[model samples]
Target: MEGEEVGIRHQTDGGQKTTYGATGSRPSSGDERTAQIAGTSDSAPVAATDDGTSGLKSAQGVPAGPSTSYSDAVGLSSRRKKAIFLCLALNSTFVMICIAVLLPFFPQQAAKKDPSDSGDVQGASAIGFIFSITPLAQFFGALFVGRIIPKTGPKMVLMIGGVLVAGVISLFGFVNDIDDWADFLVICYALRFVQGIAGAMNITATFAVLVGLFPNNVSLVAGTIRAFNGVGFAAGPVMAGALYDAGGFTLPFLVHGGIMFAGTIWLFFTLPGDAEVGTGKKGNKMFKDSFTIPWSFVWCMTMFICGTTIGMLDPNLSPFLEDEFGLSATEIGLVYLVFAGTVAASAPVTGYLGDRYINPNKLQPPSMLVLCLGLVLLGPWAETNLTSKLWRSIISLVLVSIGFSSGITLATPGILNAMHKAGYEDTLELHSNLGGTVTALWAAGLTIGPTVGTTVVSAIGFPKTNAIFSIPVLCVATLGLAVGAAYALKDLYYRQRTGTYSLERQRLLPSKDQSTAM
Candidate 1:
């Protein structure tokens, strides 16, 4: 019976297989011969039924299907997927923490000179460069990493990025001893640029992985990820301040680098190796296709605005606190904690709403409105009198966090939903590309925001800059609300008329097809 498929064969009457003798005669019933012939060896293969039950067979005796236990053991379970997602979220949080950790220390770092030399140190422009270079480098990082990911996959990209980030951040500790200001500036700028590239790769790859893992719940998952980032942003400054207080400039960088390195190692082992290049067309065709969805453009613009608003804070906020309130570094960090803490708290809530209750298309106006409110609160309209500074800062931070949670956080899900509705296949490649483009636009805004805010603050002062920024933001929000409402009404009309409503269907169909439908 070597290589023979032996199992119980069921007949139409639901009877088991009957044994036949060598001469093709059936053994007589109630005879030992019949019992001996019917008894098969223990090694005989057991077949499965259609319901995944074992010890069952078809008429022809072929294995019915795979067993349920075997399937459960081999396939990834829901619990395991969530665990992996949590790990990735933690990794993202670490990345954001690394970015924000230096914000509180920038002025001190900028002013430091070699102890042996008593010369004029670098100025605010040097500080500006330090703050802005990372985002500028990220622009290129996002652009190239998007294309490279299709070949290397996310796991390897993250591994490489993690190493680069770890190495570059560790180098920050060494810059403290340099005597020459020019050398110090060059070194800091170079390290930041490399770190930006590494960060871009890590973020781009991580997002692609998340989207690939959960196509149906992109918004919710994206929100969870953002929430983790907010956690990092919330924790980073405080940690950095404490580390700096304990061990000076070197300690924070070294400790963070070690943590990043460890996370990278964890990713290498835990992350699955299923990422592959996208099947969709790239370059001009991809770009052209992205624009086919109206919401894509809106998401990009919204991201840009989000970046700008955040960027405006990076260089200006710390200095503003110092000048206006004379707060110490640790105290300033607490102020930052309010903003990041709020963002962390609100992101998941908004994300959940976006997925379950709020329509992705409708998120833009509300998000913009919230952002405008934050901007206005922080502007000249607020009383900057000494007694009110504390409350003003707290209220403004809370509003900004809420605004960002609703507006910027929804951008990813909104973009993804729009792509899906537009007939694009939900593939890692498409998500990667779109994510990269959006990230790049956001980075561009970040790059512009600090520089613009710095220049504008220098000319018109801080209060005027906030007021000026709010004007355009309010305008954009108003326009977005009108457009979103119009689209909603149009969809309602089509649904009533055709009994099946899809914006993509309406626009994509030819003129002749549309006339017949009407």
Candidate 2:
């Protein structure tokens, strides 16, 4: 016991260095003192009060979080960042394709499977039930994926997710072989639910990985991935249509599924090292530090609005274009392409600015305001008694798409940035948890959106509904922007005086038992 070694904790606050030995033995003991608090030096221990330990702890007797600034916390290599970005791009570029490829192709195919369904009414209904299973499953699955990420590690979770999604999708091609309607519905629904859970896993882990790897350049990285997401969504129908034309219904699923599998393969080789993504001390915890900081809710609300609006348009927009503007299905699809293009084009630019110059609060609110204006214009100036013009509609659609892109890009990083100021640990699990919170809400919004779009539009008409939706967005954006600005100023003032943006919260830090290795 005399010659045995013990760990000692050190902290420097206001030019004072305090030391607390784990065994309460003085440095005069024949033992070694390891300087392990973010590599701070083994400076001479000070003559301290409270047994040299009470000030270093919290009321709960848990060890305090680090006092070091975020910039000094950790460093990641460029090679690792590239590996992460590749994994994200591949995953994003293919998952949506796998998901969306069925949209333009499945209902008619399923309807034909039933001999009595000549009119295809029951087919449409049954197919809708099948398609809806995935998102609904994902809604619940998002709640648990974060907890799993910290245990299984992100890379493995991602691998399993990718495999599940790809496997389910590839198996879709075999559905044509089944003739009985009941059996077909059962198989389709089962596959969809499996893929849905897989999607939840993939998205949650991908976001968590991004947060840990590219904390400094989050906006650009997120924006780039989002760009790929839009591309995949836009390309899915086009690819499906083309492949169906060439190789029939089975080809589209097989091709898209194969693409997703390729992404999974690339991810296996590229991601450098695998570990449980986060501190993951808590699973599916929503807003882990909301009491300390409340910004995550604001972004969550923004995303909910965005998702609902997207869902709203998906059900109503094409018909509106056809009936109101006399556009054909092809033209309407081109308009949809334009919308996706705007999102893809603007996301990275907006994200780059968010990282370098603009703050998330300032960026998101204004972008939503732009969306509000676009919606109003799309609504024929919202009760101004003028008919909506085609050009104006296109412009409005572009604005709406860009706003959606900006809000999505802001959601995760915006929440995480606010948390860091409160001194949340930068663990993969932490990112996954926050990511799960926003993701679940977004899925909820989408789930509710179609119903709202149909009912609201029918009740008050499109123009009034668009105008009404703009009001809540405007109110939320104004409040969020104001709060963001206030915090920005507060952070600036805090940094100018104390030399750090963080309050350096102490309760959230790792316990001494957890740090004996480092």
Candidate 3:
């Protein structure tokens, strides 16, 4: 009854009295009858014998299949994953806000650079130049970070970055004259570069770790991080403006540097060690050098156009708002808050929608369209006779936020996807270099955009300049989307038509385009 049935006639090693029995007990009349019934019936259940044979019957629970067990074990636990993502997002928010805090003060700082004098062209230019210089260092530092991360890992880099940045901030307090600026600038640039390196490592390494740690809801993690980034960019200005008003430029820098340094240290301690996380690989070459593109000139043009608009426009916008609207520091801060708010609020939803419901690549164009509208409103509407033009500018910037968020979410992922498809297995290095390339493009745009925006507006008038300058931005964003789409379409067409796509050859073309663009 309990297990297999054995016959009394079964032989043993030595002659002994033996009888038919079930596994648990001697066979009763009913048990014997059931065993007899099992033998006669073709469909009767059977149990395992002590000798591992199936004899008398009993049922066993079926074990789980491999796929079912695997799914259960690997799928991210939604609650735990969300918590980790939330914390990381919070960190991103803090970092972003810190970076942009100085932006709203640029005009005021320029104004103060020569309080006794008027027409502070040199002062404004110097500030703008100062802002631009950091990105250059940051650009190189980011690449260096990418190279060093696998060896030194993110933990050490972040710790070092924080300390250096704190020192730079403290040094700003002692700057007494223009001569002092040179040393300060060098320090600032160096610190910013290191900060950028740390930023790159922290973000990339964290994202990679999250993907493995969470598994099921990667978009949620990305959204949280990105949303925080937006929040920081938006809120930082207001906080900085308030601080500047109360404590002056010197105080804000000192406090900010100290606080940020503390944060960096906190992150160093609270975050896991490099051993707990995986580093994919590091490459010696710059990111852009790793890839080649077909139709090189076209894509190169597209990258420049895209970079110019995104990077250049924001830096100029702060100053333009000041000169054009006569907005105070608080008002300028509010503008950034709006810009950042729009980005932060939309990032998570957009990330989710892109990752889940919509085709990821397809999201790029619509977002660009929104960005174009934003730029158009900001630039062209400056001359509108209506009282609503100022409000319209605000509305337009909101759209820009949407577009910007979209571009960020799509562009980075899109490039990564492209590289992976093209068989660039060293994605970390590729991404790092790609970031620098984008940063350089952005920096160029930032440098040129302000000079051109101010000069062109001064010459052609604000409305005309806004409209004209916006054209390049619109062209670039649209062109980028188009080229990217074309790349995707070409791959599909070739694969379906000829059963394979020449990815390596196609990649080489973008490289050529880069050289042509340069």
Q: Which stretches of candidate 3 lie over 4 Å from their true place?
A: 1-87, 103-116, 176-223, 244-250, 275-307, 318-329, 379-388, 425-448, 477-518
TM-score of each: 0.77, 0.79, 0.67
Candidate 3 or 2, higher TM-score: 2
Clash counts per candidate, in order, are 0, 6, 17
> Model 1, 254-362: lDDT tens per residue?
9999999999888877775532233323544555655566676677677787888888876677777778788897788788878877887788788788766667667
Better model by lDDT, 1 or 2? 2
Q: Mark the regions of model 1 whose C-alpha exceeds 4 Å error after superposition.
A: 1-75, 114-122, 322-329, 382-389, 492-499, 503-518
* Cα lDDT, all candidates: 0.68, 0.71, 0.53
Q: Best-fitting candidate, measured by TM-score?
A: 2
In the range 176-276, model 3's lDDT, one tens digit per residue, is 34345456455545555554554444454455345444433445455556777766777776677788889777776777777777776666655444421
Ranking by TM-score: 2, 1, 3
